[model samples]
Target: MSQLQAEYIKRILSARVYDVSIESRLHAAPLLSRRLSNTVLLKREDEQQVFSFKCRGAFNRIYKLLQENPVSGVVAASAGNHAQGVALAARELGIQAVIVMPQTTPGIKVEAVRAFGAEAILHGDDFDTALAHALALGEERGFPFIHPFDDPDTIAGQGTVGVELCRQHPEPMDVVFVPVGGGGLAAGISVYLKYLRPEVRIVGVEPIDAASMHDSLKADQRVVLPQVGLFADGVAVKQVGAHCFEVCRQYLDEVILVSVDEMSAAIKDIFNETRTLTEPAGALAVAGMKRYVKERKVSGQTLIAVTSGANINFDRLRHVAERVEVGESREALLAVTIPERPGSFLAFCQALGKRAITEFNYRYADSGTAHVFAGVELPGGSDERDALVQGLTDKGYPVLDMSHNDTAKLHLRHMIGGPARVPSERLYRFAFPERPGALLRFLSAMGQSWNITLFHYRNHGAAYGRVLVGMSVPEGDEAKLDEFIAKLGFTGHEETDNEAYSLFLR
Candidate 1:
């Protein structure tokens, strides 16, 4: 073996982490295996004492530092898992630990560090500022700064995970997916796995919005990202560390980038399989592995994904739940246009026969045509979404699929409702089936002689779909409109004179 390989392998074999870190389980994912037709395994490092694999590297690095030379205390800067890891390790060793975290760091993480008996200092607003302050503090206090991922000892410590993987799985393996943030974990795992197995492919996974390692690998040099998405905050690093990049460049077979939705879907997948919710970063390897399996159509191969941490903030779950469907291609958002006439909305609903309508919103913006923002649950995934769009376009509806539009998903849907002025307009509130043909049948019975101005419908996971409709009647048609509405076979009432409508939608 080459000296570099020999050195890291020896270091990994001798690393001191068991004193503070456990050998996490290599769990079989039967459901995921059946879905992909592959033998999928998840390395559950999220089950660590700190609920993260970071303690392995942090403990090893600090333990080794003390062995070579006596140190009274240690200092480190991190806003997430690493801070907790370092503080825990220092406490175990009976040494003082100073952790500098960003002021914007969640209170949960700050309190977690303090719980580990470390001095938690809030400084700056972001990680970079906290890091600078930590470095300066270390110098001022004459204490060693425990680098999160760059140091040789740290990488060696993280490499222990690979040692356990080989010992535990032992069977033939096709690929191992490791999450890359600053590249430390990837570097450590990739080098050891490649050296020991040589043939097993080691793939590094990164969030597309924070893909410093992937970009660096492609460019054959380190490149800093201007900014990174914080959905997976644990791995939202702007640049890969120098030592980590060098090691990963040599050891990793390839790097995969995944989107925020993919990660969210992956978190859901992990939860479905293991009954455990992991932070977004913890699910990166699974997200990348799923993408790889889909892109390559590879089946029956043994694949492993390292679930790195579970330090998720509770509030992020709602956002994750909202985006998981789109991430998995199980929902499609659409913007459809129909004529601003009485039967047009009914015709639109008819075109969407038998498919569950998830959302619908409209307003009387123009007299000639109206735009509708809609969401449909896709039982058939992307293929169904494509067919639905094509069918709508073929049937003369101008459909713009916003399923993949992040901005539209995040903001445009909520911003779609507002006041509009329409002369002789009458509004009605109605409830119909949340299912396929209820709206179609109700609107069909209501007749198409008058001009339909504004409409809104939203499915709230209930049996009934609530709708608000506005119609233009030429004074004489009020009774005619009421007569048609009374026979529509659904519960509804006129809201034209309602004070709330006058205040908001008039």
Candidate 2:
């Protein structure tokens, strides 16, 4: 081992974190293991007192600072998990703590800091701004600023995780995946693990949009990302820390990137296995492991993922759910062109055969051809989805695979309709079973009747699927439209005069 690795190992052994942090349990992810045909283990750092592994680093640094020189108080800047860790540490040591958090920080985290008996100050709009204010406060008030990452003591503190891993699972392991944010956690774990088990691969995982460590390693120097996506806010650092980058550059086997959808799917996988929800950043290692296994076609080996934190906003679960299917390759979004006629939808359904329809959207865009936005459930992932698309193409239907299209997934699905000049446009909402042939049944029932002008349906995994449809009805034939709907025998409500339709879709 090199001198730096030896030093980190020594520092990690003597780190003072047990007073404030627990030795989190290592869990075997049975569901993930079965699916991947490998033994998948999760380092359950999310079970810490502050619901993150950060408590270990935060406490270690604070303990060392107090040992060297007694301080009355300390300050820290963090938007989420780190602040809670710092606050919990200070409370345990009976010292005053002030945590400066971004204005956009979730209320749960801010309140969590305060609950830990630390004074939480909301300042600035982002982490950088809050960090600057924290530094200024530290200088003016004669308080030491506890860094979220980038400090030697902090890195050593995080390294305790590696120590526990070695003791808990001494069996052979093919790879250990660590999440990389500012790089402190990765650096700590990599140095210790690599020094002890040179044969074990230590891979760091990062968000593709916020891959500071990956970019820095490629450039052979720390490089700041111009901007970062906040979806995985915990690991969205612009630049890796100096100490962290140096250690990681030397010890880490490699770094890999995962997309937001992949992270979301990993979160779902964790929930399925452990019945626990993790933040996007917390699930990074799992996402990376999945990608690595698939890309390398490696199986029947031991793999570990560090589940870092669970400090997620409850509201964000909705967005996570929406993307998880796509992330898991279990859903495909497509734009298909079918002739603008009464039986086009039924023909499209015939083309799809027994495959389930997750979503369908249409509007009266053109009289020549109608564009349909659809989400098809995929039981067999990418290969199956490709075959389905190819099958549609063979039948003379033009298909645009929008599964990887950002705009199509995020915006176009919801905004596919607007005002149309159809002479007698009327809107109605319908509810039916969210299963195969359900849409076909609806389309078949309304066959060739009064020109279906608009249609939208999305399956939310509930027993019933909801749909909004617009139809062209001659002025004197309003009763006939009602009769047509009554005969269809589906539950629905008329929205022809709905305020939203009047303003936009009408």
**Which predicted model would earn the best TM-score?**
2
Predicted structure with the largest lDDT when compared to the true one: 2
Candidate 2 local Cα displacement, residue 137, angstroms:
1.2
lDDT: worst 10-residue window of model 1: 433-442
TM value for model 2: 0.96
Instruction: Flag regions of model 2 displaced more than 4 Å.
Output: 475-477
Model 1, C-alpha of 429: deviation from truth (Å): 6.3
The C-alpha RMSD in Å for every predicted model, in order, reads 3.0, 1.6
Question: What tens-digit string does per-residue lDDT give for candidate 2 at 1-506?
Answer: 78888888999999998997889999998999999999999999999988899999999999999999999999999878999999999989989999999887878789999999999999987777789999999999999999998999999999999999999999898899999999889989999998888899999999999999999999999998888788888887788899999998899889999999999999999999888999999999999999999999999999999999998999999999989999999999999999887777778887898778888888877888988999999999999999999999999999999999988888889888788988888889998876767887887787776777898888887988898888888899999888878888899899988998899887
For residues 106-185, write the lDDT of model 1, one tens digit per residue. Answer: 67778889999999999986666788999999999998999888888899999999999999988899999999888889
Clashes (backbone N, CA, C under 3 Å), per candidate, total 0, 0
TM-score of each: 0.90, 0.96
Error of 1 at 211 (Å): 1.6
All models: lDDT?
0.88, 0.91
